[model samples]
Target: MSKILDAFLNENLQNLRDQGLYNEIDAVEGANGPVITINGKQLINLSSNNYLGLATNEELKQVAKDAIDRYGVGAGAVRTINGTMDLHVKLEEKLAEFKGTEAAISYQSGFNCNMAAISAVMDKNDAILSDQLNHASIIDGCRLSKAKIIAYNHSDMEDLRAKAKEAKESGLYNKIMVITDGVFSMDGDIAKLPEIVEIAKEFDLITYVDDAHGSGVTGKGKGTVKHFGLEKEIDFQIGTLSKAIGVVGGYVAGKKNLIDWLKVRSRPFLFSTAVTPGDVAAITRALQMIMDSTELHDKLWENGDYLKAGLKKLGFNIGASETPITPCIIGDEKLTQTFSRRLVEEGVYAKAIVFPTVPKGTGRVRNMPIASHTKEMLDNALAIYEKVGKELGVI
Candidate 1:
């Protein structure tokens, strides 16, 4: 550690290493798609969030290449300057239409989008009613806003309603907002948006939904907000282009005024260079693919159901997943890590996620089944899981 650096940094890292929590990242030799090549091994990749299999799509790649040829590699400066390209404006327009919102604003990344949007609307005098298991980005955004953060039990509408009523009655904040992930990334649990909308209406709370994993995978490929039929009610429909959208960047779709406010106030939007034309074009095309039909979405779900059933049949506790993301729940962290390592050794590329990504004792090997997976590939992976689970006595 540098002598001038904050003392707490190394202390926390040391604590993590002492607790056997330090992770060593594995590098993929080639691009990661349905299958990945790491360490000269082609493994059945069940660890990516490439839900619709668009991450490696030739169509998206060609679109990106075309944009690069036409617009160059970068957006010259921050958006307020000259960075806002025609593709950027077009992407935002397409995104708003895709999310059924009046207007939208793009960001450098999903993490920055959270930091930007939350603080843009919320402040020290405001309060944020956040879901307990929401993404770390959401947590950090709330912290940066300097808003009083009150966590409600995960997807517990009753708890949310009670907290909202109490916050309103207390008069502690100038404005109150409820923030949640449309679908939890780890457990793949869908948010109860209809109930949340009702609660938000009862309390007049500003509603925000980060649908990063939900877009192109839910609501017949529209998103979670559309799936729940609450498109107009959610004040902020946050999403990312990197995951299912198969590109880099994030955006917030909402009322024209809210987006207009964010454009002027959000620090990241003001400071960071805008998304490049290539990424913008790529993501716009990806959204078009999703909206065209449920072909890829259906294939993803088919693969998800097959893999979940196979793991359960092997006595591996696959958690309550409603989406393509499935977690084979393992009780111990070390054992879960070992299990994933063994799976890799056997040509399966599932990764283990433990606390504090998920609850303690609920450590899991999260699998992301993509539309690109063949039934034969799925069957092979299941056989490997059975072999590994039996060897580890985890079944």
Candidate 2:
């Protein structure tokens, strides 16, 4: 390696470590459920995105096994080539049904979905009105499109309306689109989609919603668009099969023309190999389960409420989260990392989130309470939290 490159790397690494912003990842020993093992130590897990605990569901496991036996593992090629298998087609159909859309298209992952969908539709001649706090993937996608990105304040409807009106009246771009996450994962706040839709209509802007964190947890498992009954109003309904569906892939559900266009124009779909047979089969089944009943969804909310109440009662600064994703706000980065480390030492596994993922100075330990967590687990975790909070002087 060149001396200049080595110096640059070393300087950056030291800076991150000195500022307490370097995140060290720990590997989970077993299934990422309510409890997990790291470094041979058992801890109550509040860090997983497995909102419904469906990742370890026995029935889904069996379904995946059967699919692997029948179709083997890989899809063999890219979609436009020879990789579009029957399982892929079936999953897309199910996605369309679940999102209440005319048709849908699947991608290798949620990040890929954004990268493909955004750039495929928008270009330098267009503009995208994005939320200030939208996910990184959306940001990268907009950049890839070479579109003029206008960021509105996070969930501030008036700001969005003002920006939309400006972009429309200016007539500087041929097409304009408004994009946001259905639920902001970091703060757990639901997007003002109803108000956003109203603004979009006033400005004649296209609407796009990425409901990665809201699919299995909101709108009776239909998602945030359905939460506000905007199924017909929104143009693009994007989501991940990993977070709530307990599988690995992403999709964009919309009108038939859009799906058809993506099939031909989206680079990821044309270039990337399709999702494996087992994962696709399991994703389809998981969507069916979410559609069939609200048992898991209801239980997840119950646990979320329980944990939030416990944390609040203990005097932790739990942010204003509308969904089950909880963040215990600790202002200083070093203290936040220390708080998370102490929790792990005491038998709870909540990870610290700091700069870049969220803004600087608003560091936090984000908790994800799922359906599988019992009263005992929550109570114990709460007890450990109180101890850590007191020791760290965070409460």
Q: What TM-scores do the predictions have?
A: 0.97, 0.99
Query: How much does candidate 1 score in TM-score?
Result: 0.97
Per-residue alpha-carbon lDDT of candidate 2 for residues 288-349, written as tens digits (9 for 90 to 100): 99999999999999999999999999999888899999999998999999999999999999
lDDT per residue (tens digit) for residues 262-314 in model 1:
99999999998888888889998998888777999889888988988888888
In the order shown, what is each candidate's alpha-carbon RMSD? Answer: 1.7, 0.7
lDDT of 2: 0.95
Give the RMSD in angstroms, all C-alphas superposed, for model 1: 1.7
* C-alpha local distance difference test of each model: 0.91, 0.95
Indicate which candidate wins on lDDT. Answer: 2
**Which sections of candidate 2 miss by over 4 Å?**
none
